[model samples]
Target chain A: MVRLRLHLVAGIVLAFAVRGPAFAADFTVPPVPTHYVTDNAGALSSATQTSVDAELKAYEKATGHQVIVWIGDTTGAVPLETWTGDTAHQWHVGRRGKDDGAILFLFMHDHKVRIEVGYGLEGSLTDADSSRIIRDDIVPRMKANDPNGAVSSGVAAMLTTITPSYAGVTPPPAAENVAPPIVSGAVISMFGLFGVFMLFIAFVIVMRIIGSIRYGYLVMRKGAPAAKKEMKGFAFWDSSGGGSSSSGGSDFSSSSDDDFSSGGGDFGGGGASGSW
Target chain B: MQQRSWIGPVAVIGIVVVIALFVGSAYNSLVTLGQAVDAQWGQVENVYQRRADLIPNLVATVKGAANFESSTYEAVAKARASVGQISPAVVQNAVNNPQDFAKYAAAQDQLGSALSRLLAVVENYPQLKATENFQTLQAQLEGTENRIAFERRKYNDVAQAFNTRRDTIPTVFFAGLFGSKFNEKPYFKAQAGAEQAPAVNFSP
Candidate 1:
């Protein structure tokens, strides 16, 4: 019975260890949906989706702001704020340096709505604005079973709040505070390790040269020592190998002129979340 | 042995060239990774400062509620003061100093809990919650909290990258050659008692 209990304990420990990656793998970050809106939960009508897409596209073209509306079933176990932040970042929903992007995430099943504003837009589209939009515009309509009205007006309020003339948030010619998301950051570090390994090899070579010179000196003086020359090559292996995995390249294949593509924006989690 | 006379000099020169190349590349890469950590640390500080800036306004707004619980807002004010009490020098050099980093993180976490407690207390006063000013502050506080979490996570990522490169084999051996240049940056551990929600005590 004790042996059985020990085996069960070991099994539970093993299960826990395996769970970390499994949980991460479950919520795969999907690519930015086309036309600036993806209603996977079928919440928005086709007509509303088309008009909203056109309005968002026009808004982006006029002001250089990218606003996307993504309606999904749920965010699963992840908190609403975290889910939207991660998704907005992965989608790169705004301009590269300006980071003037916003995403309105509506999880129908979870009954949560969040407006994830990019760093550049944080000044104009403040968290208070986002919260008010959700509280006044989105949550009411959502509670009334009108996802269409909720999304359209919520996005409208966001656009109005962030309009350059109205909000007085002019897109700065250059954003000094916002840093571009460091792509290939981990990959560069991997190269650093490889460089160190080369350095180690060079160190070994230097030692060998020193030894050969000393051996030659001994031979000239003592007229030949033992022929048994020991060559101990030190193998330095990384115990924490593969610890820094490179963030995989996000495929941006949809480059058609009319297609809505992310302009490589960064988010600092300046947004608000609400539930009906 | 007479024919091999040229070999020693050639081998020495060859090894010298290799050493020079490796040293140049290794040192450059270490510098690059270190700068990334420093830049990320700046971002973490920026977000924390943003949160701290919001606290005074938040406290002022909450103080308006008639007969509101003074203890909760006072606790938040005290926590914010402690967060500010941490010396700028220590904050600037925290990446290198694990103890300072821990203290900084603990103080910020204390402030975070205090703020959350204040928010929880606001639930009792519907009048305060309805007011546009109070609502705006609540939203800002929530957003700032999220930003703190986001920036902290990014800081940890860069710090981990630096630590991994500095401590991994081969790199580990060479990292010491540059004295104190590549110090292992400390990571922000998950907040203590984060999983448990703040316990709100109700007085009859």
Candidate 2:
């Protein structure tokens, strides 16, 4: 029985040990979205849209990861029902103001891309860089029907040109990771333990009462001399014979002396009463 | 023996975890806002460069047609000279030298006035209006002006966002650490009695 109990306790402990670490790991930082679109209508003419679609299809064919491109107005509004197909998502690409253009892109992996280039970017990004990504990376890949290569090349070019110093900005990856989520496991365990402790205390008290009653019945059935003596003491105590005798002059003095001695013994006596 | 209770510890851990998540998210938001401000600043620089590049071409075209208007040519020359002098490095040191911004503002204002004068001169030349090259240059200049205005507004918007994040409670605690202080850059206020992009009649 002891070995079985030990085995049970070990299993419970092992289960908790495994679960605790998993709970902690669950609070890890979620990956930042990488695919996004920008709002620059000038950047996305019908020609560009065709190129984007072709690039996405090629990407889907190569990587087996579908890419969807949805064009919306300045404010990100799209008809939900039109977002059909197994691999398609909506995005906003329009000019907010004279110089303010936004581009939002979404990758199949739920990653997002956001590019906002002011009118100022036109001259800063040489026609070479712009055309290379659109023409060399995105355009031809789409035309040749190689979407995967196009997206990979486009993403690489974007990553290369986007410097940390541009406008004193750093990408989200460089930012410090947020703190882990708090664990509910510890609190749940504490409550469970408290509940068990209360249940154990009540069980102990109930078991002790049942054991005493059973012992009393066993003594009466056996007709033991000790049982008879126990009955006489209870009978005398109930009838007031023992009380009257104890209250009498010399007996009362002896009883008081006994009472004082017993009270003193409780402080230093090694004797203990067992319940079960 | 009573079973050991685990609920108290579990509840304490849960509370701590929630608090950690909340604080973490707030810090991340502040950092993102800082990066966005930086991105917007890049856009501002791009537009500024575009305007700078167009200045020489516009000046050359105006100089060819406005030979008789010597004063207008001089104004344009002086304004261009002043613009060239106000470097990006000087603007970066705006806090240490507040006067630099004033000087920069004055140069830009002078340039605006010079361009206005040049336009007024072109109004007198019927032959210049009919030239295809001159008309194209004029259209490009107008587009460049619109671009400049757009970039300025964008810069201001980004600046406002950064400043707001810095000044607001909780986030303000770390704003100073990032060197994000309130920068009082000069805004492009409209010149007194200046008409909006005036209609230039190019048809002779």
Candidate 3:
């Protein structure tokens, strides 16, 4: 019975240790691009890409917001929202705390489009606004075989919606729907504590043995009367022992100057997805 | 010998202080994670409420369509009512209580299926689908659904962190010291077949 219990405890420890990596392995989001406009699918013309990139750079300078256009081949079997939200979060597209970033993702082969608005930007660029942009600006132009017009005008509409204090943004009062900013730092720090936890477990087991030995000595000397209180405390510790430590932390330092990098923005899956 | 006597007591006191400090830090970390779990629960509720808030407008819009299926819209209204019937107190304390959390999730999932069914039924109504208002509502609904999924995933992530921290050995000792103040948070299991959204092709 004792051996079985030990095995069970070890199993729980292994389960917790193995859980984190299992989650990260499912969908691999690509690294954040150094450029504001990353046209992996070559969906946009060079002129359109350069103009959009310059406009986004200037906009970020003016209002600390980050908007990027990414054109990809596919997101594989992963759902569009899951992939986009994860990418936006992993990229940390907007300023830390402000979370005012938006990404316009166009998957060429998949024929899917999404305007993933950051939590802060969701207020200014509502889901309806994003949908309309895809419908009126992107979808029609894509249907007409004008990818450049589709991206340029769609970006222009987004900027116009959010610029000058999010003026002209309207309807649905989705303030209730927007997700709060996430604390990715907590996740990183949590991983470091795994090794600390392992040391703690070893200490606890040693302490437990010492506690029992002392209790046995007291019982033999005083017929188990006075040490009962101390024994109860040891039992409490015994009950709480199971489960393992955390591990594997990645450094997420955002570099400065000429290279384009995310300002640590957060997305709450608050934008629209459409396909043509 | 007198000086040597002080060494034993001093060494013991030093060890006691070190242990106290470790225990204190563990207690603090548990408290932080517990609070985070609560905050994430609030976000889940907020997004769920957003979906609930959209139901009335959606049902009304669908109701206007000629020869629309009354059964589909009625099921949505009924599911919405069931969702509303779950008391606020239960929702507030859901993290600490798995049964309540499961009940809450079930109600929300019921409403989800009902809403999806209604949308599927609307494919027959091309005229209703053409209206600008309906399209906007559809967009908002899609956004709201995505938000629900995103927020739920986040809640799970934080809850996992809290549970992991709470269950680990030394912290487990501190967690037990706090009584039920740090109950292991319940996680949302992906419902079979319901994890994927029903395909609603918007292409003309």
Best by TM-score: 3
Ranked candidates, highest DockQ first: 3, 1, 2
Q: What order do candidates take by TM-score, descending?
A: 3, 1, 2
Regarding lDDT, does 1 or 2 come out ahead? Answer: 1
Please estimate how well model 3 matches the true structure, expressed as its whole-model Cα lDDT: 0.80
lDDT of 1 by residue, A208-260 (tens): 67666656765666656332232123223312222422122233433566667
Q: Which sections of candidate 2 miss by over 4 Å?
A: A1-276, B1-31, B92-102, B177-196, B202-204
lDDT of each: 0.75, 0.42, 0.80
Candidate 3: where is the Cα deviation over 4 Å? A1-25, A164-259, B193-200
Collision count of model 1 = 0
Better of 1 and 3 by lDDT: 3
**Model 3 Cα lDDT, one tens digit per residue, A235-263:** 52463343322111122333445346776
Each model's DockQ score = 0.15, 0.01, 0.22
Error of 3 at B60 (Å): 1.3
The interface RMSD value for candidate 1 stands at: 9.9
TM-score winner between 2 and 3, please give it: 3
Q: Compared with the true structure, what per-residue lDDT tens digits does model 1 show for residues B50-160? A: 888998888888888898999998998899899889999889889988899999999989988888888988899988887888878778877878888777767766776
Task: Tell me how far the alpha carbon of residue B34 in candidate 3 is from the true structure, in angstroms, after superposition.
Answer: 1.5
Locate the minimum summed-lDDT window of 10 residues in model 1 chain A: A238-247
Error of 2 at A175 (Å): 37
Model 3 per-residue lDDT at A172? 21
